[model samples]
Target: MRHPTPDPPAPGQESVWDYPRPPRVEASDESVEVWVGGVRVASSTRTLRVLETSHPPTYYLPVDDVVPGALRPVDGATWCEFKGEAAYFDLVGGGTSAPRAAWSYPRPSRGFERLVGHVAVMPGAVDRCTVDGEVVVPQAGGFYGGWVTSRVVGPFKGEPGTWGW
Candidate 1:
């Protein structure tokens, strides 16, 4: 399929189209937080942002940063050619539960070992997510876990008719 024209990024912003195909992992010091059911489930100053072509960044927070007992291992798993097998988790807090709302790579592929012990949540499945105090917009498709923030511009892949992109 032909690629869509990328939206030009404004100053201080990045275009998703410019991200690499194999995906890159970079550490972010920006404060990242995740709230579920009105409960703050996770927060961290140290996060790993996964950047891939056509997708917004997916932030992975360290397990130690998550609130105690907030994540419960659940059934189901998925594989990523780049990241390896991912196990799902149910996020429970404030009397609310989000099944399979989070995932982590127990044993990541070589060169992606930094993903170990870090968890990434689907923004759409949680009550809210923020980066440096800015609320994030979840990537459009239900399947992808990218978080959309003002710093990133996209004709993102999860939107309708973008499956091939």
Candidate 2:
């Protein structure tokens, strides 16, 4: 069964990027961008992820953030105990060597219902992540979250369950 957006760790929620993440909610009408291979792929003001590990919030850029035209559907899909089924994408129009460099869930489980339609591209797959034309420096593991250059909390996971992201 799904739980309510795990209330952010409370005011004293200790870690990094100190702040109550409120609750993983729906992406607003606004949109964020994800650029891989130095090319903008998609943009969507969608739901992002907030963890206690050691980094900043992971913004799940909506499929709208992606150029759509630049992505080619791939046969890669993964399931998460918390999130849901993820669909993969191939960076088709950019100089990136990755045929399938990003993934998302159009329909996510209730636990991760907020992530539906948002896309998170592998940071290692991109040169840099820029929000509103400003490049965002990653925290530790290079997982892009559109978080502007600043004090990051910790390292996010690259592959699922690898680092317990």
Candidate 3:
């Protein structure tokens, strides 16, 4: 598939097409929050943002910032060539459960070690997710966990017909 033309980023905005290919992990000071089943399960200012070409930023929150007893380990795992193997977690809160709603790399690949001990949740699987107080739109398609906020512009990768991007 031909690369989609990137939308022009307005002032204070970023275009996902400008992100790196292998992906870059950097510290983020933005307030990241996750809610599930009407419960605020996680919130943190000290988070990591993973940026890759054609995808919106995916925020990884420190496990310590999550509410106690909210994440339960689950079976199955997936591998990311850039990050490493990820173990799944069932997010439980407010008497509701979202299976495999979250994941983390227990031992990340070199250069991506910052991902260790940090969790990324699927916004579509949970009730809501926010970045710096703004509700986020989940990246198109259900597989990737990129968080779409007003600060980012995209013809994001997960959209239909973008499989080969």
lDDT, candidate 1, residue 17?
A: 93
lDDT of 2 by residue, 55-117 (tens): 455556656656747767889688755467878877644566455567777788776676766
* Alpha-carbon runs more than 4 Å astray in model 3: none
Cα misplacement distance, residue 105 of candidate 2 (Å)? 1.6
Cα shift from native, residue 130, model 2 (Å):
1.5
The local distance difference test score of each candidate is 0.95, 0.54, 0.95
| Candidate 1 structure quality by residue, lDDT tens digits, 1-165 | 889989999999999999998999999999999998899999999999999999999999999999999999998889999999999999988999998999999999997999999999999999999999999999997989999999999899998999988
Q: Quote each prediction's TM-score.
A: 0.98, 0.61, 0.99
Runs in model 1 deviating more than 4 A are: none
Rank by TM-score, descending? 3, 1, 2
Query: What is candidate 3's lDDT per residue for 59-104, written digit by digit as tens?
Result: 9999999999999999999999888899999999999999999999
Which residue pairs clash in candidate 1? none
lDDT against true structure, model 2: 0.54
